[model samples]
Target: MTHQVTIRNTGHRFPAQDGSTILQSALDAGLVLPYGCRDGACGSCKGKLVDGRIDYGRYSEKALTAQERAQGYALFCQAKPLSDVAIEAREVRKAGDIQVRKLPARVQKLERAADDAMIVYLKLPANERLMYLPGQYIDILLKDGTRRSFSMANAPHDDEFVQLHVRHVPGGAFTDHVFQTMKERDILRLEGPFGTFFLRDESDKPIVLVASGTGFAPIKALIEAAFKKGVKRPMRLYWGARRPKDLYLNGLAERWVAEHSGFEYVPVISDALPEDNWSGRTGFVHRAVMDDLSDLSGHQVYACGVPIMVDSARRDFIQNCRLPENEFFADSFTTAADKAR
Candidate 1:
């Protein structure tokens, strides 16, 4: 039996099928909803359940506390409607603006930027272009039924095919395929323009871009977009990596620094092997930020990379660097291989 539910604040009706999450139905119908992660791991999709019953799928308690759930809060990604529901939620704008779409993509080029980093270029058909914000990411749905998310390294301009930076993980499923098995002329299915971690153009606050490994992908896109849009905002980038090899885009960043007057790039190295012949500031990447900027209360930070880096940076920036917690935006790249550890 198809369930009919009235969307809160909408005069229209929706057909809710059994076991399907509310967010999925909204996306399928082009009625976008504010969401992130879509795995019940991020609370970006959390909203009030004004009136309804739904099962809470496998979600982390960190995303939604039991207290919040009891207080009518539900994660849209995990909530499946069992009755007519009224959700007091944010309108599908900004991050939810781009409708989710699946498109045929072909690997146009593969450029190995570093010993362990590869920037893959997927070409779209002439007339098939992905409309994505600067910091959004797309999931390459693999044939094995696994999804790998990568942020667009290039800004969307005149309908260009999407771009992504893939870093090799020691036994990673997707990265291994990308480095060893993937090739040009390869066809893949992609669904996205997802993630809420994008630049807030409205803020003129001094920007601090923090990146680790290939996490710089989205930060690069965001900075490029900001420059292309002629944003004169003073921006400084603090890229942290283990040894110089991790920052494969060092030259590219130097070029950006030379071209942009308001941009500054600082490379922070965590560990330098003795034989590697390294000379750089050595410490936690976030600690480097703390060392440089004593006060980050007025700055907006966009950080990406390992969860440890984001978490550490967030904690330090708030507690030590004086950065407001809300101003610190992060995209944690949690890999399956890291799950075991």
Candidate 2:
């Protein structure tokens, strides 16, 4: 059965085939919807369901809470319409024409950024170049039908190689291989350039960037892209980690601060041992932003990190810090354990 899906805001219409997700169907019809981690783990694709019923496919509880579902919200990436429906969702005009392809990549280099994090550089075929926004990510397709997603750490202008920061997850098959057994020059299949966490170029608002652990990957790309484009907007970055050493790319951020006129970097450490001699900002990274900028009404915030940090920042910034809800863009790094929950 085919159902007509209407966008209440734009009055655009598309056809949703039986068993097809709303996001997939929209893409098939050449309409773009803001989305990330199409597996129903990230809440980026969430939207208001104005009318009609849906299957409400399997999803992480954190992404779509019972309270949110009760409020008529659904994760379009996983929801399948039961009949013709109308919904309220933001269409991503910038990402509409970018194509998603499955291509082969060769491991060019592997640099150990930290004890638990590895920076892998992938080189695509000589004839192929992936055209993607700064904050997009690629999914490595495994032979066992599993996939691991990682954001590109390099900016679009630096497209000679795709850089990914992979954190070692204990007992994770992919990370285990990457840290222990993977060798240079190995071939891997990948698909993507996914996510809607890029900069809103049209907006001239000051930018606040928050990152935790490997979440810095996409933020790095975004900042570099902004710099490459000569975006003069003021930007501040707050990066958090359990220990100072876990902030693998700290030096690079420092370099950016030294080079960029309107850029600032703050390193926040939590759980730092006494012997480590830590003396910088300490506590949750998001709190540092709140402490410095009490009023974020005129700022655009970009956050990427674990679910706890992203969720807290989203709620606190909008409710307490006077930030507009639409100005807060985020990419939550959900793990296998997160999705299982």
Best by TM-score: 2
Candidate 1 C-alpha lDDT tens digits along 74-124: 988888888777776655443345667888899999999888889888988
Q: Compared with the true structure, what per-residue lDDT tens digits does model 2 show for residues 126-203?
A: 989998999999999999998988999999899999999998999999999999999999999999878788999999
Poorest stretch of ten by lDDT in candidate 1 = 89-98
Off by over 4 Å in 1: 1-18, 25-35, 42-53, 61-74, 82-97, 158-161, 319-322, 337-341
Q: TM-score of predicted model 1? A: 0.83
RMSD, every candidate, angstroms: 3.7, 1.1
The Cα error of candidate 2 at residue 219, in Å, is: 0.6
Local error of candidate 2 at residue 305 (angstroms): 1.5
